[model samples]
Target: MAFELSPLDRELSNKTINENGFSVYVSGKIKIDRSIKDIRHPRCKGKLHSSNLTTASVIISFFEEHWETLLRTVASVLNRAPSGLIKEIILVDDGSSRKYLKDELDNHLATAYPSGIVRVIHLEQRGGLIRAKTAGAREATGEVLIFLDSHCEAGINWLPPLLDPIAANYKTVVCPFIDIIDANTFEYRAQDEGARGAFDWELYYKRLPRLPEDRYHPDEPFDSPVMAGGLFAISAKWFWELGGYDPGLVIWGGEQYELSFKIWMCGGRMIDAPCSRIDHIYRKNSTNFPKAEFGDFVGRNYK
Candidate 1:
């Protein structure tokens, strides 16, 4: 089901689309000042357990992203995740032209980080998503490295479950189930069942089906083979050894497949942890990006 927008929502949406070429502009204007109490899945609660010793550094990268939604992302992590498990939060700005994301964000965050646990790094050149994320990953000092979209909200107790897999084997890359948050109304929604990421020969990503027989227990992890590029957690050591993301890639699209293949080739496993969750604002763009940049993804030479 889609979110119903009110008049205020419509106004904000129109303003946002004009700026970002999508609905995230509306998310920027949204005030998530108070905690989002009900956007959680029923399964997220009820006796959740996670590894306390497995600490992590959450990295978020963005270019011209919304402000309010970004802080909500950090706030959700702070409010729900165990303090000891979160070593730090790193925000990387890929040459954002926006004024607020710079000093305004730094100043705003200055009061927030007394111990210097959270930081904002600015790049002079616009290094697309892949490079920008790599910049954040380079600064990570935790055992597990988590990469989250700048416009996402953390689900209750999400970090521990993602780290649980890596603690078993450093070669595991674990991702939480993603919930949907409306771009216009900011309404949160969850899927009835769980699915994993897959891709076609055309290089297009799709949601694979889930089977009940695959589960030995209600909260067990499933093999995704691949995961959405926007969100996932991997061992810091393995991520660096596997070469983080392909530096040859520019912007977005093909990087997910590139990283997925590298993980499989190197004897690493990718899992979808349903017990952990996060809400993402699925970006929608009516027109395709410039062909010069993204055309290679669909070309016959993709093999």
Candidate 2:
């Protein structure tokens, strides 16, 4: 499957924010490689295996995302992920208002993923990430449901490792080793495979180094206290049965912990698989997200 965006796409993809919230960058049309290979941990290479039984539908929720970033996200999945294992790619538009995002995106996907592998779902009104992901999950047909951020790029052979444990036990919810993609330069970088997501009482997440026990088996999946939330995979049956994501939670804050605690309290376990890795663009929420528009929704979670 080949992808070539039109001149209009290249122009829109070159869009950058250098104002108050973001770092300074030039406006003279920058070029980024769409087919950059991701760096993976050497330990994750030959030790992993996949099953033909447990297939997945990857759900990517987006609001008013950069035209190029969103396209690259989907392309990464197409380029790295196994076509047969990936039943469908669901792109959820949370009522975006950008002119370039509307018809142009629809037409782009129509050509890029013409094999009916990609499905674009447009919401009539804004529902934030929670609702957008929920909407995407509702439309998923695969046995396992995978969720990724709009700016994420999965590494080579990233899918099988995440699904292997799920195939063994469907109730397990798994997250890949999330690496940081430089927000400004679009450079793909690797992270310590032992690092996992953690947060404090205030619900702010940060990467914490793994303890001695975590490195006991570098190739094995380590149990995690919490997930980064933007990327993870859960069984379709368990997700709906576990009530999906909290419908009451708004925007993006506090949702990760909510799901984390939900999984633990309900006898389900969350694991961070070292074998599966993905790169996500490290963009600041203050500039790239829609949380500010729905700020008061944060109060709803506490109430």
Candidate 3:
């Protein structure tokens, strides 16, 4: 007798039945998010866990003009990453103009790093960061995937902190404390030295040093309902399981908010780890890509 597929499974199968050659099968009674145990570190049996948490892949999505900065960012990662970590670095070129990044970019990266782990995926047409990130995520092979912008600089011990929470079977999204650097002079500033990151209804981002007097503390691990997507890490399985970044968003704006909300409301948690810190270039005028139509996207996401 042929097994009958439930409505949710049928929907998921349909969604993945296209040219991608991958299928997403969802079950109605089984909650995909809760089915898996909490994220945890691997055992030291000298054997790889089926969960695949030993190594990590970093995704850096960049546009045309920021190629040089992207190179520098990758160099920083290579310089600071602890030994025997980082399985690979996936660089997604979201339609760049520089001949170096397209034709000779990979060669240059190979020459610079010489580790043979860096891979580049060039989009023939510009898909913006949202699409670029999705493309990179799809290609990522590591068990844990960390997403960072092209202009950010990695801090010492940055890689492990992002993966530690996930390794511990927390099943929660994790982000590090992000510091800002002046775009012109590269002067670094710690925007949130004492506190973790937070968000507000205004959609503005900030760091909260202390919990409010009336707020409830359950005595569990540190948890935040929302986190800045500028630098966040998650297991590759959970990422795709959460449906990845909403393809509905255009360019770069509401993607982070969507991930933050979905993780919390869908019965997962988001945390800000004070132990990890990354520096990002803050600019008065962004020269990377064209101004995105983020207002309409935000409205659609919120509504």
Q: Please report the candidate that would top TM-score against the real structure.
A: 1
Better structure of 1 and 2 per TM-score:
1
lDDT of model 1 at position 301: 25
Candidate ranking under lDDT, highest first, comes to 1, 2, 3
**Models, CA RMSD each:** 3.1, 4.9, 18.1
lDDT of each: 0.78, 0.77, 0.66
Kindly report which residue stretches of model 3 are placed more than 4 angstroms away from their true locations once superposed: 1-53, 194-202, 212-221, 291-303
Cα deviation at 160, candidate 1, in Å, is 0.8
Candidate 1 on 28-116: residue-level lDDT in tens? 55665545555444555664564445889999998877777788888887788877898999999988888998999999888976778
Clashing pairs in 2: none
The 10 consecutive residues of candidate 3 with the worst lDDT sum are 32-41
Which pairs of residues have clashing backbones in candidate 3? Answer: 38-169, 39-168, 39-169, 39-170, 39-171, 40-167, 40-168, 40-169, 41-167, 41-168
- Residue-level lDDT of model 3, residues 141-233, one tens digit each, is 988888998876776556666677788764678787677644433444566533445677877666665465312332122666567677888
TM-score of 1: 0.88
Tell me each candidate's TM-score: 0.88, 0.87, 0.74
Q: What is the lDDT of candidate 2?
A: 0.77
